[model samples]
Target: MISYFNDYANLCFEKFGDRVKYWITFNNPWTHAKVWHSYNKTWRNKQQGMVGISLTSAWGEPVDLTSQKDIEAAERYVQFYLGWFANPIYSGDYPEVMKNYVGRKSAQQGLGMSRLPTFSVQEKSYIKGTSDFLGLSHFTTRYIIQKNYSALKGPSYHTDRDLVELVDPKWPDPGSKWLYSVPWGFRRLLNFIKTQYGNPLIYVTENGVSEKLQCIQLCDEWRIEYLKGYINEMLKDPLTTHMEMVTEIVVPTVFTLCILISAILLMFLLRKHN
Candidate 1:
């Protein structure tokens, strides 16, 4: 498997060269690091970040903003769920805060290091800001609670954040397991990226709803609504307007008007002759 992946990476570089500036080698390895690695050791390594892992974040909300525990847990959840992958990808480092919470037993057994991969000094420079545009795939986030360390399952990498996650009972469900109606998280995440990652170019890669068996085909009203809400938030970002080009919209309108006036004048002259 490692050989095949190495060969594939070589093939991509050989064929694409520097032309393919934006390359997504891997995405959402956390889900695999959790479920697959739990069952099979071989599968875990096979599925690990051979290229890189996308820290696909389900940006959760705090149940009680006023409560210190809730706020800390919410931040922890963000760090564990999002920071776990992002920290390594950008800074080539793991969330040390996560290591402390993941507990001792699991840490010794390799579950802690199992999920997070360390980069070589060379790999660190290669992976940092490798993306020409950061494409984010987000849906909904869980509201987190600080549960007892014993109450948590698996390893330190999993529970180091000291947060247990659940869907907001009050938030309207979009029918998927980890998804709920939370557009604010999307905005918050964008702002976080801009602030943390020096405002790189961003593209909303996957933002949608699970309609379930309620409908056969994809009408996607929920997706449309989600985009509208989040896009409005993105526009509010101070950097968003920098890319806003007046030339593209205005040039076409001006050209069309000039053509229409010329055509109208030509027609009027022909009509007078008739």
Candidate 2:
């Protein structure tokens, strides 16, 4: 599977390297990531373009701040979702919390060793220092709590994490039932990426809200306000350094996006200046 990615990216570099200056190796690390490996070895010396990968995660807020377990649960959620992929590329191995918890769960399930897999010392050396930048996609926030349920009896990825995710009912609902506007989570996730990944060159590969398709309203006031809140947060925060771009996409019925079009241009300028 990885070999296929390696072949395709080499073709891309050979064909389009002169045009495409920035390259993202994969959408998520659970998928292909050979471009960074390939580019650094072969194409990068000639192409001179940067290569990185994209990750998506939600900010997990502790359900009970005073509870140490809940605090760790919140941190663990990010590590499992974001750090599971990013940590290996940045630090050359899985997060220690993930190793300990998953390994313990695997043992309880009667496995001789962790089902999560481990890398060789040489493999770690190869994987380390592979990426030049980091791309991330984030939306919303979830309240996390220690899992105390029978779900842990299984050995899937979620069960091993031993955490329950929830949300605040009072959060603002834009247009989609699933997506609530949580601007604060955006900053939290960004800061986490900065600290966890040594403040690498950051690009918000995807960031936006969804509106229900039942109404084809051209003047999307809710979306405008949502962008204002989220983009303003990124502008003021000093933690999210080297931010390249905040990409967005909206799904709806055929309608001229006169309002969102204007909002997007304004956001581009704001992002450029900020």
TM-score of 2: 0.82
Q: Tell me each candidate's TM-score.
A: 0.64, 0.82
List clashing residue pairs in candidate 2.
none
Query: Tens digits of per-residue lDDT for model 1 on 25-77?
Result: 55664322221122123222333322223456777667888888888888777
lDDT of 2 by residue, 121-185 (tens): 98677787777888888777889999854434688888888899988988886576667888888
Best by lDDT: 2
Off by over 4 Å in 2: 31-33, 150-152, 240-274
How does residue 140 of candidate 1 score in lDDT?
80
Clashing pairs in 1: 102-156
* Least accurate 10 contiguous residues by lDDT in model 1: 31-40
Candidate number of the best TM-score: 2
